[model samples]
Target: MKTIDCLGDMCPIPILKAQKALKLSPSGTTIKVVTDHSCTLESMLNHFKKYEITSTEVINGVWEIFITKS
Candidate 1:
């Protein structure tokens, strides 16, 4: 499990970082992204959905996304 803390990041920073991390991660790895921005969360979710990755977002502002290499 890899944890990504984007708590204070704004806009595309969190989403960009998460995408980079996912590219470097192996299959079946889990990445926990902590962000305070709802827009970033939504963008992240959308990206994940596009890739068919499994993700869960908590209204409290935490997004736990799971990715598996195909």
Candidate 2:
């Protein structure tokens, strides 16, 4: 499990960082991303969907995304 804090970062940075984490993660890795911006969350969610990554969005504005090696 790894945590990525993108609280102050704007769009793309959070997602890009998450992508990098995923690339380096082993199978069944869980990456928790914290972002204050809803748009960034939405973009990240949409981007994850394209790769079929499993994710859960909490009410507190936290996005928990799970990446598994294919």
In model 1, which regions exceed 4 Å deviation? 51-70
lDDT of 2 by residue, 1-70 (tens): 6888887899889889988988998866677777778787678768886454566676677666554444
lDDT of each residue in 1-70, candidate 1, tens digit only: 6778887889788878878887998866667777777787678767776454555666666666554444
Candidate 2 minimal-lDDT segment of 10 residues: 61-70
TM-score of each: 0.70, 0.73
